[model samples]
Target: MERPRRPSFSELPLRKGDPPYSAWGLYGADDELGTMNLITPAVTRAAVAEVKLGVTIPLDLPLDAIAKPFIPSRVPYEHKLLARGYANDDEIRINTQSTSQWDSLRHFPYQSGYLYYNGVTNADISGAEANDKNGIQNIARKGVATRGVLVDWCRYAKRKGIEVSPFERREITIAEIEEIAEECGLEFREGDLFILRTGLVEKYRELSHEEKCAVAERTGAEAAYIGVECNEVSARWFWTRSFAAVATDTLSFEAWPRKNSEGWTWLLHEVFLAGWGMPIGELWDLERVAEKCEEVGRWSFLVTSQPLIIEGGVASPPNAMAVL
Candidate 1:
C-alpha cells in the first residue's frame, strides 16, 4: 500500500521567527489542525496492525480523582444533578484542564498581543468572531488515533535503583527516552502518540492526605512537576522524531517550577504548543499500560483519542485509549 504523503521533516523550521517553528503554511494559514495533519487516512488504516491483542486500555484519569489539585491554577470540577429523584441527566462544570487534559494551541500565547498556532490572535481564542481558530474541536471530529508508544521511565528507574521523587522537578532527557526505546526494541514512527510515564500519578496515589496537603502547601507557588527535558536538545529530538503528540503522567508535560534559563522556560510550552502546533497532555494514568507492556513484551499499540468538540476552548481531557 502506498503511504500517505505529507511535508517531510526536513521541511520544518517552517517559520523564520525567533523560536524557529511553524507548520502554519504547510496546511494553511487558516489551519487549526497542526501536527495532526500527519495522521492521514492512510496512516490511520495502517495503524490497525498495531492492535494484535484486542485489549483496550483507558488512559484518562477519573475527572474527580484529583481531590487535591496537583496544579494550583486548575480548579476541581463540580457535578450537579439536573432535576430531582426522577432526573436522568446531570450537569457538570469543569476547568477542562483539571484532570488528564490536552493543552490546545490557545492554552498559551507567545505574548499578549502576539499570535498563536497558524497566526491566530488573542481574539481568536476569545471567539471575537464565529470562526474556529486553533480550537480543540478542530482536531476532535477527525479522531486522534495513531501508533502509540510507551516509554516506561519508572520501570527503568527502578531497574537502575534510581530514587524517583514526584514532588521535585526532574528532567528526563532525550537521551533517556532514546535509551529506553533501544532497550525495548521499539521504533518510533511518524505521527506516533508518545506516552511518557514518570509514575507521578502512581506516586500521588500513594501519598497520604497530610502528605498531599504538605506537598501542595510547601510548593505553594512552585510545582516541581517531574517531566521531560524542555531544553533545545529535547525539542530537536521530539521534532526530528515526528511524534505528533505527547502525554505524561505528571502535572505538566515539561518540568515545572522551571528556571528561566537558556530560553528553556519559554521554548518547551512555547515551541511545542503554540509555536509548532503540537498538543501537550498531562496527568494521564499510565500504570496499567506500563504493566501490560511489561507482561506482553510490547510497548507499541494503536492509540486513539477524541477531545470534546468545544469551540475556542483552551484545553480538554484526553478521551484516550490504547489498544494492544
Candidate 2:
C-alpha cells in the first residue's frame, strides 16, 4: 500500500487547553494522526519489531565496584522465612538494587510540584499505595510501541577519525547529531524513539576509579563533548515533532551527571513527561545494533522494546530487540 503522506504540525487537532508544547502542533487533530507522522507504514503494521542488534550486556554494576570507603560491609540480601511453603528467589532481592533499569514517574518529583507525565501531585505521589495507583508502572504497561531510529555517533566520529568520548565524557551537538543522521541516510520522524549510541557503557567498566571520577566530574554539567547536544533545544524539537520518547546508550540523557538547569528541569524531564506525557529511556543497549547496521550497510531495522509491567514500580529493564 502506498503510505499516507506525512502530515504537517498545523494539520493536527489540538486538545482543549493542551499546552503549546504538545506534539499535536506538528501534525493534525488526531493523536494517531500525529503519531503516524513519525513512523513508516511498514513499522506501524508490526507492533513488536527488533531495534537493537547487539548482544545484551549486563546492566547492573557489581556491588563491590560501588562500595564506599567507610561504609560497613553490606551483604545484598539475607533470607528470612516468611512463609513455610513459599520460598523467595534471591534474584528478586538482588534486582532491587539494580541501577540499570528505567525509571517510572514515581521515581522523580517535579520541582513544580507535579508528579509525572499525568500531572499527579506530591500528595498523590506520597504513599507507596498512592504511587501504585498512578505511576509509570501502569502508564508504561502499554509498553513503548513506535518506530526507532539509531543515530550512530561513534561511526560518524570514526568516519571523521575523531575519538568519541564515552557517554560520561562526551557532549554531542545538535549539528553533529544531524550530521550523523545524514551520514547514516536516516531522517528524524515525528513520534519516533530516537536512540543515539555513544559506546559509554563499555568504557565505564574499563576506566580506573580516578579516571572515572575525573571524567564524571568534568562532564558533570558544564562540560561539553563532541557528540553531546543541548537538552533544551532537543526537547523543544522532539515535542514540536511529536516523538514518544528519546533514548541513548549514555547513563543520563544529558551530557553526564550534572546540576539540574531550567532546560533540564522544564524540558528534559518535566515538560516531556508531566507536560507532554512522553517517556524517556536511558542507558540503552545500542552498540551491537550499530555494528550490525555497519556490517550490513543498512541503516534501517525493525525495533521493539518491552518494559516489565510491575505496578507502581519506578523503572523496568528494557526487553529490547532489533531485526535487520
Q: Pick the candidate with the highest TM-score.
A: 1
TM-score of each: 0.91, 0.67
Best by lDDT: 1
Candidate 2 scores a C-alpha RMSD against the true structure in Å of 6.6
Report the number of clashing residue pairs per model.
Answer: 1, 28
Report the lDDT tens digits of candidate 2 across residue range 63-111: 3333221112223333344654666433234332233345555555445
lDDT of each: 0.80, 0.53
Task: Estimate the lDDT of model 2.
Answer: 0.53
Per-residue CA lDDT of candidate 1, range 1-324, in tens?
A: 443345444565566763355555666676677778778776777788999999999999998877767666656678987776765788888888878889988887665346788777776556447466778887787779898899999999999898969678888888888899999998988888888999888998898888876666655445577888777777778888777888888888887766555754465777778777889888898999999999999999998999998887778888999999
Count: clashes, candidate 2 = 28
**Worst window of 10 by summed lDDT in candidate 1:** 1-10
lDDT of model 2, residue 205: 60
